[model samples]
Target chain A: MTGVTISGVGITPFESDAERSALELATAASEDALDDAACSLEAVDSVHVGNVLTEALDVQGGLANAFVSAVGLEGVRADRIENTSASGASATHRGVEAVASGASDVAVVVGVEKMSDADTSTVTDAISKLTHGREYVQGITLPSFGGLAAGAYLDRYDAPREALAEVAVKNHENAVDNDIAQFQKEVSVEDALDSPVVADPLRLYDCCPMTDGAAAVVLERESDAEGVHVRSIGSATGTHAVAERPDPIEIESVSRASERTFADANLSRNDVDVACIHDAFTVLELLELEEIGFFERGTAWEATMRGETARDGAFPVNPGGGLKARGHPLGATGLSQVVELVWQLRGDLRGDRQVAGAETGFAVNVAGFGNNSVCTLLEAP
Target chain B: MTRGTRDADGLRVDEAFRCGDCENEWYYTRNRCPDCQSATFSTYRLREGELVAYTTVNVTPPDVRSANVLGLAAFGDVRLIAQMSDDDPEVGDSVRFAGQYELREGGEKRARLTGVDGDG
Candidate 1:
């Protein structure tokens, strides 16, 4: 079992830059990553990009190659990897494997998505296709499914509504110093609580915004790398559709992936210094925390409300503000998590948002109601 | 629609192919007994089971406004996803089929299941 090392990482500012196309953003991020690693396009052997609905968004086919060529990486093996919203992590996993297996000395992974240009309903309709098409024909959107899961969580665990609100407040506070985040201003708890409801038990603020952004990471085998070590990588899949699951909050796939990664790294939950669990929805963070074994079942809300997961709390979770405040460009989200982890591990982050003494970190990417999941463990060099 | 035979419990039961020698019965859909690799099978309407998993569709098809609850039920080792009639169902709750219900206007149909009597 050879180890893979992440030599460098990069990200585009997650904001409404309607003037620039998705490929332009991707090129910028890719160049940043390559430059940070002190490597050039000639040194890279493969390129992996993640974009959820590039075709649906009227982007040309072979978009990955198009972006790579624009970034002056033509003649390199390039391909797109999509797995619902978790496309970024899926692509990263592919790139890591390429390096670890000696198929390539260096591989670059990029995630980009432009979601704000499309109509909300159209975006919702497109995302719904990730579920059972027959089910989507019934008009089930992500928000609807999220609401159902939130309701179940609230009912079964007696999860407090206020605790969920706390998640938004904490993330927003952390985002205040994140210049690249979509929402840089903090909001009061009352503002979060009073926001319009998108789905029952979930307000507008509780959900991540429809953001447009890109993120990239450069990976090289440990023997050829000059950076942080990829201690372990694990992925798992569960029921295909959310309706097929026994409990939405259980997230069996995520739990399995986390357990496998921990075992592979020969570390326990207590060893993780920081974590970035997918917070597509605020409640998702709570469920992920519990499912990842950070806290006991039915206690994530309590842990959150008690400030256990705050930026300066006992265990800093989502110091990058997570998808909730940092903005969620579906394709870029998983890669964005990796970028934050790399920066934290390297002590490169500026301002008040840095996680103190962070050495080992974990990132969990859940796709389509935990149907597909990937977990990665990172350690400082 | 052809009316299926009803069992002693008054639940509708449809006949399906079953290996006479294997004595294996399956209800919804299958070409053969997956267990023994026998191309033979029999059908019996599911009588009793428990909800294995469930989720509600808040944004339903154009025809429906209220959330539609759905779940998978297990009768012995056989499991299938079906429309749930109960408002809130917990995993392991007993369930019984309530016959077929119209799922869509274009002849789409599905059998409905509810919590067992006195088990709700």
Candidate 2:
């Protein structure tokens, strides 16, 4: 099988709100990625758009076709991939598969979401529907899941409430240097803990804000491209209902996906130099780290409190601020993680945020409450 | 395990399903058993269960109450998520199904759990 390489990656400034349409943001990011690759639009054989809310929130459809038209690309195979919040990574995986299978020599993967135009309640209600139909009727929002999990984690492990706050503190601190991050300011643990309660035990700072943005990556069939190799991608599905899982705090999907990713790449967790995890909620960073084998169960909070996952720590995670601070534009988040990994592996970032001597990187993007997950491994060129 | 044969009320969230083949119990509605893929299944009412986790949802949907409490309760081997009548409930606390109520505007009437006496 032919290997695939990320020739270029680009992203729009993740903002709490954006004035542009999803299609416009997607086109701009795709153009930037194409330019970064030094490849013309004509060289692109396929376009994969990762998006979820445009139709529901923006009242727009046919985003892929519209993006291709906006970019003046003709007759290229266009497809839209939507896996809820994991849509971006799913699109990246799809584009890489196209290039790896020789179905397309050059593929563009873009993830975009426009959420600011909608009402706050509308956005929350729409996101709430991502859960099982039965659970949706119970009015369980995503933050409720975080709050429940945080409560359970704290009680079960006897972890300090400050441990959860530490995640936001570290990620926000890292975002201070990320120019495209939505919140480019450090938040102290006190600030996080004092934030208004969105759900019991989970203050506002623990949750990712609704964001609008786009990110794109160019995948090329193996060549002399000076880019990071798309080593492999693994995906898995868990119980649809969060309550159905035997252990509410255990994200089996992430564990299974990471297991498959490592096994397929013939590597171990120790091989990962840096990681961009799906920290949609502050507690998620710790839970996912443990699930991905970076830390032991119930000990992730202890490790997090010790700053082991900080940018300068032994197992650096989310140096680009992750979803908590970098902004979670739903579909764009997964691709944004890959974009950060590409930059890290290329050593193109500034000294402050760079993961030094990074040769391998891993990223995991999860759907609602770990209903599904997609994990990718990237190796330096 | 037949698909789409149940009446509207038959699909209520309060009902739990048991696989005849593997004897596995689940809360969600599915045609086949997740464990054994058996089409033979029976439905039972979720009357009482132990709370595995609970949260007071301060931020609810527009139609729901502001400080809605929710919990994941286990009925035998089946687990279901429902709104809690108790303001605060701890893990391992006994909770019984209170009744059905609309948790959201235009939403279905879902089951609600309340902590047993002095258990919350």
**Could you give candidate 2's per-residue lDDT for residues B30-110 as a string of tens digits?**
789999999999987777789998888888888888898988888888888888878867789988876667777655566
List ranges where model 2 is wrong by over 4 Å: B1-9, B106-110, B118-120
Taken over the whole model, the C-alpha lDDT of each candidate is: 0.79, 0.88
TM-score of chain B of 2: 0.80
* A304-341: candidate 1 lDDT, tens digit per residue: 98899997899899998899989899899999999999
The weakest ten consecutive residues by lDDT in model 2 chain B span B1-10
Writing each residue's lDDT as its tens digit, candidate 2 over A147-264 gives 8889889998999889989999999999999999999999988898899998879999999988999999999976746688988998999888888787878999999999999998
lDDT of 1 at B109: 47
On DockQ, the leading prediction is 2
All candidates: CA RMSD (Å): 5.8, 2.4
Model 1 TM-score on chain A: 0.97
Docking class of 2: medium
Q: Would you list the clashing residue pairs of candidate 1?
A: A246-B53, B17-B41, B17-B42, B18-B41, B18-B42, B19-B40, B19-B41
